[model samples]
Target chain A: MFNTRSMSKLLVVASKDQLDGIVRELYRHHVFHIEDFVETEEEGYEGVKIGMPLPQASAVSTELLRIRAIVSAFGVARSDVVPERKESVSALSARIDAELPQIEAEVSDLVDRRNHLESAIRECETKIAELEPFVPVQVDLSLLRGYEQFSVLAGHIPAKVELPVPAEMYFSGDVSGNLLIAIVPNERLNEAEQFLFEAGFQSMPVPGEEGLAKDRIAWYTQEISRLRAEMEEVDEQVNARKEKHQTFLVACDELLTAEAERAEAPLRFATTDTTFVAEGWVPSENVEALTAALRSVTNGTAYIAEQDFDPVNDNVPIEFDNPDFSKPTEMLMDVYSRPQYTELDPTLLIAIVFPIFFGFILGDVGYGLVLLAMSLGLRRIITGGAGEKLLKVLRNASVSSIIFGVLYSEFLGFALPWEPIGINRHLNIGAEAHGHGPDIVLMLVVSAWAGILHITLGRLIHMRNARRMYKPGKHRNKVVFGQAGWILVMWGILFALWSMFELPLMPSFTGLSPIVAGMNIVTLLGAVMLIVGIVAIGQENSLELLELPTVMSHTLSYARLAAVGISSVAIAMVVNYIAIGMMIEPAMQDLSLMGVIFIIAGIIVFLLGHTLNTALGLLGGGLHSIRLHYVEFFTKFYLGRGKKYDPFGMIRKFTED
Target chain B: MAVETMSVEVAEASARGLVAIGAGLAVGMAGLATAIAQYGIGTAAVGATAENKDIFGLVLVLTVIPETIVIFGLVVALLLLF
Candidate 1:
């Protein structure tokens, strides 16, 4: 399509209220108009009026409501969906005001409960700390065992009596064998040790024997258990408080949501800093009322003027004007950007090709079925209407895979015992015993044909878009020469190759067989087409011209079809061989269980690997297909320079959150 | 004994080769991802700067966004080597 751009400017002077009314009207119609009323610099700001067709008013209303619901649900503050009704906003304001006290009360109660629990925990911790120094302790048995040679110290020493009671009693930390430790800092050790063990048990201690510190260690141990129990109780209380807070938060959210949809009986005008001048199309009938309203709000400062409206140009790329009834599936097409809608809606196209490619790459019937089932199941699991939309795409792709798998005549790692039902069994080319398998060639050729078709359709879209934007004459060459030229060159090259390598010597040139000689002659025309189409479509950018070879190479790159098919077969063969080998001896010995297990394991592995490969293959193939469509195909005639439609009354700043 | 030792060394050599190959693949993928992510973020950063020069500090932080991916890769590679 030829690129067409038009620029216009408008200015309006009105009271703040009238300006706001105009802005609200513009937002209701999805008309993007900028309000440049900055108190600071305002040099780049200009007003523009975007037009809408009167016939689409209801559709516009539905779309606006949908957007509003989505923004409300998702918590986005974009009010441009439907102009916020003044009555509703004021009602919401009143509700927020009424609910503020209750919300604050609940929050205060939660905070109080949390604080009480925290203080209780602190008091428990303080009590535990006070008792920590007085708990009992046990002796280290390993250290005691190591010093067991001095076992005579186990029992009480009766001032140098015969060997004391058994060593076990002392090591077991009994009080009978417990000795008083010196109550001394290092400086008074001599005096303190003499006052205790030195004076009471000289024979057993001999000399330089230190008193025991068991009682002190025991006191700390007992305190630890007591503290742990107290902390655990406090923890339980804290958890209960946290749960209560969570419940309060949930209630708060529900309350706010209910408030948004609540009915109200109020009509209050909001004070405004918002000011806008909008240009919009109305049925010449509504223009009178619109003007009257503007006059009333502006106190006679507003004006209405007529401008030519081109519905086709306004919604170019999107077929919103008069949709073709024959295309029932157009409802599935989603526009990422309205202005670039026509040329850029490649997502649905990608959705169609991705699964087909994935299944082909994977090439395992069992795996394909599994993927279909998995996707369908996942779709069922997803909740909400939005989830259902995502599921719809997955469901479609799964169906495509199931179809492809049936066509491929594969089930698990084995070929179907009989031809699939419904498909003409006798005429099935896929199952024919041609060394490379007739289906592989058929599939590869189809892939190439799909590529050709994609490029052609993209060109057609661009041609329509170009003309719609009023650049019909400039892109005429692309429709006639550029598009048809590439198609011919591609087929011509194929025909020439077939004739050179595939014809029978002579009499073949008889009737329809001079097609070879004709092909040779057609090769020159094809070559010329290849050159002209490339040059015309590329728009003469030197850097883009460098991409010519890359695009051309990828056009032929569907050869990966053969590569993927061969890999699938090779992997299957290796796995099958290993399985058979493992089971051979067992089968001979009549160990059917082992043999069966081997076969099952082998199939599972083959299925798993092939399924993964196919999935990845489909993704790569689909993305590559779209890349070709967007860059090579659309570049032929389409120009994507339209600005996206983003209405005002929305924040333009990006926060990291 | 020599043959056994030689076989052991060969096996170790192959294990090391596998590690090297895996590391190379991991690093290469990470680098490519970082480059793509950085290109998008960098473009946005430039656009932000064009809108407001005062946001320069924020712009610098956003521009460094892709560095994290590469740093993760580097850390993984270091762990594997050690």
Candidate 2:
């Protein structure tokens, strides 16, 4: 349960003619993780090079590209269609051969028409904007342009100015600026331009259309509407095509993708003039089945053998073999990294502990129900992927929250009828009538104890990992001793604190007589353990001795479990106090139209306040809980960077054999 | 004699207020320190995440590692207040 699945090195040798059969069998079995071959110039490796892909690879790729283009043109998304049943490969191939070209031609033609209409619509809109500035002038568009002897200047000017030469000018005034048009003789154009430049004139080119500006604008608007109608028609045609062929396109895409992968599989193999060799990793239990499948496919011409390899030296891909209950936690594990084949898998431990931490932080019945409903609702909508996996994790966390909520007797910061069966988080901030206020102290101590236990578990796991990684020797013994020293140090700190302070739930050793000076027997024992632990750790690596304070600090870090929970509870109470005590109660004292409005506003406030708090609770509880594992807990032992096992196969959803 | 008794009462009240202020400062200053530490780390983490999205988890853990200081300060404040 703690280890990844065992893998065996698989080597398959076959004649060149049987390469196709071997590839087919391997892909169907879906157990091989092929390691690509690299050419070498040493020894008997002459003429042994990486094999070329099958001759049909190029054709398959071309067909795959064409299908993809059609699929994209139709705007078909995978989620847009649900496959009713798996399609037969032969039938799909025949359909592709018969109908793909017609579909492609129709889609391309419609797409071209759509593109043409869109660009034309954009041109008309641009023309309309250009003509809009001239509408106030009320001049002919032909008169604004096509002036040879007279230079026409038209644009917005700050104010009217006298031209240096005699010219015909039109002026219009508005809030933005004055629009002006001047027709000056070409002989004196430079003098007129210089005079306009001084008046802060921003010039625009006269549009190249004929007739009145308003008339041309009206024509362009009508043209735009007509083009838009045409565009809509093209879009409707495309949508119809999408509705008709979306399913077939999605299936064809899947089938062609698989075919392309199969055709290109030989590129990973090592081949000579007569034979090819494929090397890969397979799960040990499936080795026999795979060998049998290969034998049947090649008619005894292929040779399959299990090659011995060292787990330490070889690059064995790691596949998690966790039980179904703990499988979803692999998402969390993957966020960090996959565990090495030889390393201990911590998925089961995380699965058990992570949700507990989440529940402890957000222990409230109302919020728990909200989260549960949200995760379950989202899970139904998002079927598969990281999002679905995350929702599954949240489902587990919400269930844990419900359990903790029951124990805490908290329902959205309101006290339940029955007394709290667990730590009374509400009591920390003056919920004394409900319970004793010093429960906060108890909560802190419990969190510290949790930290101690969690860190000790990490140390033990590290020791186990050390034993597996190293042979019994001075170095291995030192590493194991170092981990043990950390455990001892944690216990020593706990014992010392217990002896010094009369903490809740802890037996006080303060009553005992002093063994040395003011130190009691328990205190002396704790001191001795601390010294010995430090010595052992220093012996392993003296630099680690500097990190002695971290043991105390890391233990204190777990106090956030109580601290964060208390803060959430405090916020929830404040929200209730404001919405009910400050607003609704005042409104209730007097009944008027304003009072009714105030009451409604108060209800809105309550709902919004609770919604914000719930979101905050999820963020705080989830991030903090997972952070504890990733930062504080995993830092103790986890050294992950294992290769993921990706077998050579496709799990077809839309197509079948 | 009456004035002396009143002065003693005033002294006790002020002492209590100081302790409260001390607790607040413990948490506040630590939070500020944590913010300062996270500033540099957060910017670099964002840059790294932009380049490669897969390291988001690792960067998140790194970004929050300094938050332990704030938690430590909170523990101290809790010790002082209750």
Best by DockQ: 2
Q: Give me the runs in candidate 1 sitting further than 4 Å from their true place.
A: A1-14, A18-95, A111-276, A279-365, A380-388, A419-442, A460-464, A469-499, A503-519, A527-548, A565-589, A592-657, B1-82
lDDT of 2 at A240: 94
Where does model 2 exceed 4 Å of error? A42-44, A175-178, A197-200, A427-435, B1-16
Q: Write the per-residue lDDT of candidate 2 for residues A165-218, one digit (tens) a residue.
A: 899988878525778899999999999999899889999889898888889999
Best by TM-score: 2
Number of backbone clashes in candidate 1: 15
Clashes of each: 15, 0
For candidate 1, the docking band is incorrect
Q: What lDDT would candidate 1 get against the real structure?
A: 0.43
Give the TM-score (vs. native) of candidate 1: 0.51
At residue A196, candidate 1 shows an lDDT of 39
Which of the numbered candidates is closest to the native, going by highest lDDT? 2
